[model samples]
Target: MTTFDNLLLDLDTASGILTITLNRPTKLNALNSATISDIHGAMQQALDDEQVRGIIMTGSGEKAFVAGADIAELAGLNEISGRRFAEQGQDAFALIEESTKPVIAAVNGFALGGGAELAMACHLRVASENARFGQPEVNLGLIPGYGGTQRLAQLVGKGKALEMMLTGDPIKADEALRLGLVNHVVPQAELLGFCQLLLMRILSKAPLAVGLVIDCVNAFYDPERHGYQTEANSFSRCCGSDDFREGTSAFLDKRPAAFTGN
Candidate 1:
């Protein structure tokens, strides 16, 4: 229930879903230092709350999920300050990528530049039919500073990422899906509802196992990280849990399992 100047937090305790909406519609919910700081805080709040099992991030207004970074703020950055700002945004986004609970980006409209980077940081992205995505930092004579270069390539392959970054052209929802940039494309009215249903389905499973799966899958992309080892370790950890016992017993009894996330 923390108050934020640039964001709105809605926690559905019964469903264990926390929806964080980016405010500042006048600028298309552009990223600034204040907004980035608020997002980091909001994510920490969700992680600390036992009632929060998942998160959905979107923009307040229908015009944009987030158009890009605040150009006014970026125009003032020098070399030293620009690196610092990029690092700060990266730290904030790393929280989203590494969270124990699932985070879904409900892209309701434009997700350009840093906005696109923010969506990429989430575990999954579900875009509305009207959503547009791009890494158009080149248009401003700069590059994507908030992990967009790396993540964009990772998500949509190097060739497509290079095409988008170099051209600074925006892609609509269908193109984004074809490029594997988004998980689902739904009507704008159905975006939030669809994300909530997906989260609830995830929450119905064992929480510990779910967290481990996220860790293992993310490790797959790290050069120094051994994904197989991580998977083995997580599997062994899950084997020792009480939920494992209940899940097996219920299967044998031909009944639905009631997992307590142990």
Candidate 2:
């Protein structure tokens, strides 16, 4: 467990849970430059750490997981800085979206604007019953720059995405789950335990195979390229990974595979 200046990072080896909490509860965990950088660095830290099998992202405070970008800070930036700002956010969250290890967003409360986009970036999402999610940047005369426009439709279907983004209305946890925007909705008291159980199941598989499926599935949605090649390459590559060998042996021996994600 470690604390980066403004972020609380707790690494639990027993469950291989690397939880990153956006720590700016005072500002409702707004995404300032420092916060974004800390999040980017924290994600990279988890990705590079072999000990971490999965990641869970959240925020401090009971009222909000994250409200949005720090509009106050951005309101004064020049054009280039503005471009850089959006790009930085896009890059950071893109890393989270494409991580080999599964990352889950435990949305405890509000997840609006970029915050909602952040949840969209994760591989899966679980929300506390009290949570409310939306991409309400349109209300401020803005668009979701961090893959929200793209990911939202993929998450909740085009009709739901259009309704949510076009109206800028927040959706509750049950609604989110029903619309397929999130996987599970649990009481706040049980959210962590429920999410951990899901993560444990994923970690029980061969990590490389999981990564392979992730890459293949993500490739399926990329507009620029055909997914056949991507899935084919991943399928072929997995044949030689160390995890594949262990998985095969384990299947034959009727025992669980011990995969190192190689």
Candidate 3:
């Protein structure tokens, strides 16, 4: 396990699930430079570990999953520096979005600005009934700089995404689900458990095929690649894997498939 100053990494050895908690309750788990760096480092560590099959991200306190980016840090940005700052955060989040292992955001409370962006980067989101989400950068005389503008529009429609960004207003958990921004909305206490169960269900499948599904889905939104071609290629690759053989053979034998992620 890797130690991080602004994040807590907990690995469930039996389930191979890694839960990463943002540890800045004082600032409502705000994304400061150090916190962003810690997130990048922790994600890298998880990606490299064979035992880590999935990830769950949440904040330390019940008050917030993450309120926003650290405004004090945002205040120092000039044009050139602002671009670089945006790029830095984007790169860290892109790592999350591109990971082969599924990542779920267990949003407990407020997820605003950069926090909202972080949640959107995950493969799935399970929000608590108390959760609130928004891209309120407009209130600070800025726009979402951490892939929020793009992902938000992709998740929700352009009209609703624009309404939220322009108004700088937050929406509750149920509204988020209706907008397709979250997968499930449960009681605050059930958020983590629900996410863990969801991940465990996904992890039970063939690992190689699971990863290919993520790749194929992402390729749908990527401009540089064709979605159908990517899916076809991934399917062909899976056909050659040992897991694929075991899966088919197990189905014929009418027993549970014990996948080794080959």
Candidate 4:
């Protein structure tokens, strides 16, 4: 319900999905500091809304999902300011990466630099046929500042990540898919719809289980954490939930399970 200068938030409570569009189409939906702040606020809003079980993020226009961070903003940063800027972006994106509700990037066009990092932060990415993705920060004499160096390597192999970052080259949607950077690549017109359908499919199941699944998977990448232990804990928690009982009973009764996310 909150208005933001950099983004548009549309929550479909009926579908339990929040669609957030980067609204600065004139600037190719770039991530300025204001826009990153808006995104963090919007993410918090979605997390607090029990009706929001999933989220879809995309750009407002056909030209881009996001071209990159605002160069003008980047151009003004000193060493101290630059470090703070990086941390701000990292914090904003950490929210997306850590969200219990699934977030899908519906990438319609250019997703470069910070934009690509934002997409990588999401649980999944569905790119349009015209979509382009890259980590071109090297061209600006910088490395990825928003967990892109980590997540990009995690999504694609380290070798591919290094190549892309080192070369400052962009890849088409199909290449992104081939590299496992994007889960699906569809026609531009169908990108949002496809992502929505995918979200609905995920939302139809037990919400608590979905959240725990996210937690368990994320633990795999944390050196200090053990994925197996996380999975065991999550499984035990799910077993104690009313939703799990309903799921089992519904199986016996041969009917669809209605979960309350308990």
**Best-matching candidate per lDDT:** 3
In TM-score terms, candidate 3 sits at: 0.99
- Give the clashing residue pairs of candidate 4, or none: none
Kindly list the per-residue Cα lDDT of model 4 for residues 146-257, writing each as its tens digit: 9999999999999999999999999999999999999999999999999999999999999999999998999999899999999999999999999999999999999999
Write down the lDDT of every candidate, Cα atoms only.
0.95, 0.87, 0.96, 0.95
Which residues of candidate 2, in runs, are more than 4 Å off? Answer: 1-3
- Looking at model 4, how many pairs of residues clash? 0
Candidate 1: lDDT over CA atoms?
Answer: 0.95
Give the higher-lDDT candidate: 2 or 3: 3
Q: Lowest summed-lDDT stretch of 10 residues in model 1? A: 9-18
Count clashes in each candidate, considering only residues at least 3 apart in sequence or on different chains.
Answer: 0, 0, 0, 0
Candidate 2 per-residue C-alpha lDDT over 1-262 given as tens digits, one digit per residue, 9 for 90 to 100: 3457779988898888888888998889988888888889899889888889899898897778899988898677777887888889999998998898999998889998889999999999999989999998888777887789999999888988999899999989999999898999999888777888898899888888888788888888888867999888888899989998898999999987888878
For residues 1-262, what per-residue lDDT tens digits would candidate 3 score against the true structure? 8799999999999999999999999999999888999999999999999999999999999999999999999999999999988998999999999999999999989999999999999999999999999999999999999999999999998999999999999999999999999999999988888999999999999999999999999999999999999999999999999999999999999999999999
Q: In model 3, how many backbone clashes occur? A: 0
Worst 10 residues of 4 by lDDT: 44-53
